[model samples]
Target: MTLSFDGTVIVPAADPDDGERTAEALVPHLTPTSSVIIVNVIEKAGGAPDKASMEQREKHAEDIFERTRRPLQSTDAALETDILYGTDIVERIFAEAQDRTADAVVFAPREGNRLAELLTGDVARRLVKEASVPVVALPQRDV
Candidate 1:
């Protein structure tokens, strides 16, 4: 039987070091039949980021998506990228999952703050708790 999933992966604007590894963690579980959506949640500010800042952020997001896309293709799954703007990432994630009817939501967790994260949920933990769909959170790997 071909397992199908309408899954949405939240690819936040990640830094260089561990972004590759975090993306790799999500690849194996995604089959060819999965409808993969790569979501980049933009932070909505009182005033939008300046042109240079905006361009830089968008470029960073695009790069992360590019790096992430390569591994999933081996599974014969295509990745679609989307940008969402909201003040809070957790809320944006929740809304996207509900709107897309996503079966699963994947995210690369922020580094460190492990204990504080569990005690006082940051974006990933909070989203996992409140996600309309199941949230698969991947932590950054130790080098």
Candidate 2:
């Protein structure tokens, strides 16, 4: 089945590199009228002491957006960026998708080992299993 990227899509990036890669992978699938909302989730420490200052995290998120924006500049897609905060990454992403009435949540799976995925709660798996809308996993192109 073919997937269309003609409506709002929620893209959650882990970091600058991931943002760029995911954006690159998604570019080929986008239409001129697509609305791409790229987001970076700052996984808050709940009530515990934070890992980094909020300012630092926000700056990092901006960096991610900058890198992500480069690839999509070639397309006519309306690009936007947001910084999301939550303890659960997947939940935050789905929340954004719901809030935006997104047509799809698209991403390129990050590479990791089984042990790492298990330790980190395997967000990629959860994204697919718990999606509220169409979830698209774009194949990562070889660098």
Best by TM-score: 2
Write down the worst ten-residue block by lDDT for model 1.
Answer: 10-19
User: How high a TM-score does candidate 2 get?
Assistant: 0.95
Candidate 2 overall Cα lDDT vs. reference? 0.93
- The true-versus-predicted C-alpha distance at residue 78 of model 2, in Å, is 0.3
Query: Candidate 1: misplaced stretches above 4 Å?
Result: 1-19, 47-52, 108-110, 114-121, 138-143
Query: Which regions of candidate 2 fall more than 4 Å away from where they truly are?
Result: none
TM-score of each: 0.73, 0.95
**Model 2: clashing residue pairs?**
none
Question: For residues 8-112, could you state the per-residue lDDT of candidate 2 as single tens digits?
Answer: 999999899999999999988889989999999999998999999999999999999999999999999999999999999999999999999999999999989
For residue 33, give model 1's deviation from the true position in Å: 0.7
Candidate 1 residue-wise lDDT, 2-106, digit = tens: 323444444443443334665566665666667777767667665765434767777877786777677666776666877777777778877887787777677
